[model samples]
Target: MGKNVNFTLLTMLYLFIYIVASPNSTIDKNALLAFKAQITSNPNKILAKNWSQETPFCNWIWIGITCGKRHQRVRGLNLANMGLGGIIAKEIDGLSFLRSLIISENSFYGFFPDEMGNLSQLQEIEM
Candidate 1:
């Protein structure tokens, strides 16, 4: 019985460590904030205001954002019908996990980046 109790205690401690040390716990917070800043600087309200770092962007609940089933990286960005007008930043290519990009019904006038094809997960690219 004592051995079992010790195992349980060790398991709990390991879980606590994992929770506190995981990158997802903090990386997402900072990344989401940067994304919010980018959207705010954009001309249109393509990104809704509710997606700040203070708000946990759960994959199932996030608006205009989608994550991979496993890695949960930013996999899709749906900015259609939002009237956003500008070139997609070259920095956006940094979202390497991106798969779907929808920018229809808006006015973004700029040359499409050739690097966009580098997104290996990309399946749909709607302009």
Candidate 2:
């Protein structure tokens, strides 16, 4: 029984370390910035007050960002009901890992970037 418990503990620890140390930690800063730039600027400044890779986007509590607990990569973006007006531009086309986008109830009107098709990983999207 003791041996079994020890083996289980070791396994759990190994899994934890492996998750926290994925190559995703090296997620391209340029890529992340590129995606960020896609977001329409707010003259009212409604996003990312302290957002940056060094600041741990997951920790700073960014309004619309969700980070994967295991991989630390951005899992989703839920920016619903924030009153603003603009179109999603090509700037966001580069982020292929985007899983969800939830921006609704705004005055944005224009063509979504065809590059959005490149984001094969998107699961739930609202705009």
Task: Compute each candidate's TM-score over C-alphas.
Answer: 0.63, 0.62
Residue 12 of model 1 has an lDDT of 100
CA lDDT of each candidate? 0.66, 0.65
In candidate 2, stretches whose alpha carbon ends up further than 4 angstroms from where it belongs are 1-32, 35-43, 48-54
Per-residue C-alpha lDDT of model 2 across residues 1-127, encoded as one tens digit per residue: 9999999999999998767755544452345555556657554556545346565555535567787765566777776776656667565644556788777775566887787787788888777
In candidate 1, stretches whose alpha carbon ends up further than 4 angstroms from where it belongs are 1-48
Give the clashing pairs for model 1: none
lDDT of 1 by residue, 35-55 (tens): 455443345443655566555
